[model samples]
Target: MYHSSTFFDLLLLASATVILSLLIFLNYIRASRSKPSLPPGPRGYPFIGNVFDMPSCREWETFTEWGRRYGPITYINLAGEPFVILNSLDTTLNMLDAKSSIYSDRPTFPMLGETMGWDRGLVLSHYGERFRSFRRLLHRFMGTRAAVSQHHDVITRETHRFLVRLLASPGNLSSICGGAVVLDLVYGYKVKDHNDELVHIAEVASLEFSCAATPGAFLVDSLPFLRHFPEWFPGTGWKKLGREWRADTYKVVDTPFDYVQQRRVGFTAIEEGMSEHDADILKWAAVSIYFGEWRGSDTMVSSTSTFILAMTLYPDVMKKAQAELDAVVGSHKLPTFENSDRLPYLHALLKEVLRWAPVTPFGGHHRLMQDDIQDGHLIPEGTAVIVNMWGLLHDENIYSRPMVFDPERMHLADASLFMYIAMILAVFDITKAVDDCGRIIETKAEFTSGLVSHPAPFRCSIKPRSLEAVSLIREANLMEG
Candidate 1:
């Protein structure tokens, strides 16, 4: 009886041991599965990955360093979340254009996507038939040769009017230029000064919205658990801000839309063509109707910022350009599209400004739908592929003295031929401008934590090289009218 009892005890012990071993094995497998196959990157702490390692300012420099350290394709962890960056131009092109089918989808960030509900914006929409529909419409309105030709007069007229404003008050050049363009694009009207109610509303609404929607600007994006917290909680500042932003956004959109709707009802004071209305107004109408929401403040802000920056920073380039204009266009006539082909320097200047400090510093984020080997690295599916515009723009191998702000490089012999090279661009800046901010504020500047980076509040001053040049541009504009 004693022998039999001992045998039974040994058998039970063996069974228990096997069960424990199996449990351990299963746990290991689960852990392995959770570990993503990500590229080499800086080690992160308990929750935040590499965020502490990065500098508050000079984000682009950090990105460039990471690219150098971890190859062209590098992975960054944001609060233990993995985000991949495409640092080189070739990699960016390959992901965005070559594999566009898979890479066109945007990263999922709650503030920019869910709260603001911008997964529907043409710039933020996923890669699908719906996105294609919006893109096609945008192309029809802004990209088509016929469409561009139709609005040529207005673009020139408005831009020239902006120049006049610069002449009047260079300090308000940024506000005046941006305000004028948006006014012409949206309402087919012009605000001669900075204090116009519509301009104030549009600018403030746009900037505020952008700040609130920036992905990492608020703590709620990093610690999503805070979202479940009560709105009254201090930690829920982002949530409260988001709610306020949403209302402001509605005000921005509805006010303009209602104004236009009222005019469409009976007002015949303005021209019927798009040349008279803001391009953004049309965009808002089209998007709101199609997607059941409107989020495009960022795009407007980017374009507006670009024009203002060019006016302020490109004075030297503009002076040199006027020399070209004087020789080809002469002082009596303002520069026109007809004279565009003749003035290569001005064209180069425009291109350089777009490249110098891209309004969208990070080109765009693309999603990888399938596992693939690129540049010998295993890029796993569901990764957010970010293209670093600053890196490409500042690549030493591609551009000589990349930081010198030299527009003249664009006109150097065979520069056009070199444009096809990996780090260069042609006429237009390909980066996307997204309205992720909940309600863009009218402050002329705000920082948002997102894939796209932009300039902060800046003052743009415009001064003519010669009084003769100013007279000539005005005369040319009058003749066209």
Candidate 2:
């Protein structure tokens, strides 16, 4: 009986040991499965990473190639900071729009934000209560309903002036019209020439800001602690440049806004109640509206120029759009905002222009607010995420003949472009030039490469489509009088 009992005790000990081992193995398997790996990317050097890979101009093309090589989502490290370049529209919607809560945060720029005080603007503000408030206030003033109803008269009048100016001297109509519209809307101030005092000041500030804002443009952005260093410190020339930019920035941000406040043309959020020196960040929201025009107006300018280039390059598309305008608006009068719904082709042309030559090609990079996993790949917090707006728009599968400019894709749209383009086309017929032999000279519609892309200055013939179209202009002017 003693031998039998000892045998049973050993059997029980062995069974317990087996159960413990099995449990440990199961836990290890679970942990391994739960952990995610980082997405694939090119290997970087020891310290300085993919810095040399980025070109100051047309970095979008390089990013596109990386996407093709490393898959839809490509990862790269710029120095110590990691970046995840999203290459596809599906990923853009899924990551940026769907999971925006984790991705909406803006990256901190030491030079532009702290040293230059540029972070106060809505475009660059951090995703927080302050940015939210700034956005909300802008919605109140410049919302679709308010903008159309409140500023319709001014826009219409300025547009008429632009058409007349094109009639007189058609060169650079895009720049002239854009400056006129924004100047009136922002300050109720009139602008006639590119060298107008207000326009000149705004242009200077914009150039300085663009130069300083380029990634890795100034060492201070990378080494933020350098901003705390004295202005007289060796190799601190960036500080002086920042001061000059600030002065120019204030000229546009304050000058026009002050005039509008004095004239009571529109709502003034700053003069309404908020104190500039208030501890709350929301105090700076109103001024952001003023500074926002630094890029906003230029977007319109670039977009219009692109459309002109497209007209010059693709005469068939231009004539088709013009035919639509002739039928809908007629040669009797210019196109108006009310006629936008009927001019589908013209609307498509505008959409095509924006897609063909995006104003903000790379778009502002978003900083990840928290750690996230996408497609079983780890994206840690503080990773700078580039949406690659241009890359996504130019996807060949989505946009057939993606590089080719076609307007049919944006089917359902507004009539704003219809009015703008129709009037321009009605007044001036765009065509290529002819040599002495009368052979049509092939025009190359090249574009500028920078933060904003515009057509490189190219010569094109701008003549009135018909004598009746010119007569309509005269009658329209008399009617306005």
Candidate 3:
């Protein structure tokens, strides 16, 4: 009161001291409260989090190892983000299925979503009305029963086309087969020329996109603030590549859409109810448009590559498969869906391929819709969840010698009897099994994130179960027509 300046200075000092005391007290309280027992994981450095660590290759292996050391539910921090990896099948069942309502949504990766146009892809869509609509459409188009009923003739014809292409030039077999199937499915056109412009663009665009998407490839994704810079800015290669990819992608997408539109116009004379095939094509086109606009066409392109790659890497699996085809099909004909029932080995082999390397090694990342608790841990809302399909497929309990490419694990003698005898010939011959089936090789991720993760162009040799399998393929080709 005697001196106003002295009083003001004393008040300011008191305020500062109180604020400091409160902060220290809060920190002490936080430390003393039984800290949330997060599942065991490698300790992270302060502030930067786990960004400076976590190896790319064998990440799945490391996660599985941690699960063994810790528990089914585990967590990891990457760039200040928490990733709850469900290690056990039971945990996945509990979270993805039991708590699916809370966990089905895909995490928002600003760089991948807005920058790369993934906000539209099927695999990345959140759990909402639009996602439901797309899933319904896919169900109608490609679900087991629906796909079988609707696309039997088309798929069968395509498979025959695949066999013929392989027989003609096995070296270009992958490109040819993938090109033919994807073109017919998406574009309503067959890839006649090996170097067709559409096919070339499709392959290049898909490959580039995949490369851009691999985890840790783009720093902007981890440090999103970097994306604020202009496209021409230095170190922003992703922006430039993304634009290039979008342009090429649009070309592939638009070509198909335009062709279908033209095709529809040509049949304008037919009454709407008169042509089922026309209506189906129209519906298929709409579905493709919805998927393309939302999810991008890269997954279809990538899956197409996956089908071909599986055959290339697992030659022993395919060789045994061909041997089964030799006995059952007897060199007289190409395998058809009609023979699929008899081709149990081929059927099992297909499932094995999907399981063995799971096109999406780390199941697409999912986002928590709201805060929830599971197994004495807090699953904070918006926590990134990785399905860890790699762990599920390689689980010891699920598959004997999970690492081995033994199609016979899924074999059923009675199941094969209904189709070609060739299906059974090789799987039953256990001696044909390769001693070292080896581990799956990881490929770079694409801009799309989840879909089209191929095994980055690797080589593996094929040895037919015996001379008979090769002879059968040769003889079948020779006898045809």
Candidate 4:
């Protein structure tokens, strides 16, 4: 008694169900054939595939633990997307360094890059002719140690200014010092004593970048189709935020660029005569140098803060460094780059700072361009590769006591860090702050979690070592001015 139309609908429904079953069977067969080749990781559920296993924060620590459990190269899938974490230096170098051609590309960041316009910067740019051009421009300017030495005076002068600021107010040395130096070098812009507009804009944009770039931060990044949704739609509030941040990001790039064009004083790769396209390349390259440093996760700022934290926690190490500074550089004048080679212990201390709390714990993620077998594991194309820099640096096999902050165990040189630490130590004594009740405030060694890591804010006493040290800091500042 059923109508003909009902019969037809039933037939169509049966046909669709059969097709879906066949497709699932085929997919299961292919996966069974390939499962043995993929790297070992935590077993995942049927459809979600390791989504629940991912940590919400401090992912580098979790990745290090995984390295301990599942070998150096560990693999995981997030809703069908493949991710590989390289936990050892050897594996990182072997894949990222040796296999540069196949691994140089960057994974697409839909939220930060496409929506917020961060892809134009060097950090997230795709690997291609434009990327090569940016590299060439940077190399021509300050790629070599010798080239860096040309700006030694600029660095020293800025460091002196920072010391003077620390003398006056002993808080937030990270942003002021890092932003000032990069601004001067990149845009010939001098930061004001308070409320620098350019610095404010850059900081805003940088924070936005960090939040948007965080993994699982935005669903739009995972589901590209969400980007096409109307802002009035439910759960599309992020689109409005993306638009606001996009404007600020452009300000970070354009404001300084326009200032340089007007003043003609900052470091510029642009020449008198060039095609518009070439000129655009030069402009972005220059901005990259500036943005890379001042972009909230500045290496200089993080390292400088780490240096303070280390000195506060280990007074014995600080006293030893001061003793060496007294004997080597003396108190009559501030330490300069020329004296770096003579201060072996100070050099070691700087190295230990870099190793103890690396600025970028998980270095930039590199995208794989093709399928390849590594260490008997099949790594498919388009895999997002991350190098666990923290794990590699803190490997117990490499260092006797990885967690301890012992400079004597280190033997490496970073010029800028050496200068910052040596200059600060020459004048300031960093110790734990004492409460009004005459009790020493305890400081635990804790750091922030992000693409760029810094020591969590802790109270510390930063003051001149002696009357003579105060005089030296003031004299150096006056001379620089």
TM-score of every candidate? 0.73, 0.85, 0.71, 0.90
lDDT score at residue 99, model 1, on the 0-100 scale: 78
Residue-wise lDDT of candidate 2 within 456-478, one digit each (tens)?
77766778877887887777766
The ten-residue window of minimal lDDT in model 3 covers: 413-422
Model 3 scores what on Cα lDDT?
A: 0.57
> Can you list the residue pairs that collide in candidate 2?
none
RMSD of 4: 6.2
Write down the RMSD of candidate 1 (Cα, Å). 9.5
Task: Give the count of colliding residue pairs in each prediction.
Answer: 22, 0, 15, 0
lDDT tens digits by residue: candidate 3, 1-481 = 6699899999999999999999999998998675566666777888656666555555676667877877787777776777787778888888888988888898766555666665555546678876776666555645455453454554445444444454455444253333444456545665564557766666665565555455556667566666788877876778877776667656654555566566653211234565665444344334343333222344433444444455554557756676777777665444555666666666676566556666566666788899877887777887888767778888998888887656676643211111222322331132212236665444232212333455455433323344564554555445532
Q: Candidate 4: misplaced stretches above 4 Å?
A: 1-36, 171-175, 232-235, 293-297
lDDT value, residue 293 of candidate 4 = 37
Off by over 4 Å in 1: 1-36, 51-56, 192-194, 213-215, 265-319, 370-372, 411-467, 473-481
CA lDDT, candidate 4, residue 76: 86
Candidate 2: segments with Cα more than 4 A from true spot:
1-34, 145-149, 173-175, 222-236, 269-295, 412-418, 434-441, 474-481
Cα RMSD (angstroms) for every candidate in the order listed: 9.5, 5.8, 7.8, 6.2
Better of 1 and 3 by TM-score: 1
Most accurate candidate by lDDT: 4
Per residue, candidate 4 scores C-alpha lDDT tens digits across 198-259 of 87887788778767766667766555566778989886788888889999989888888788
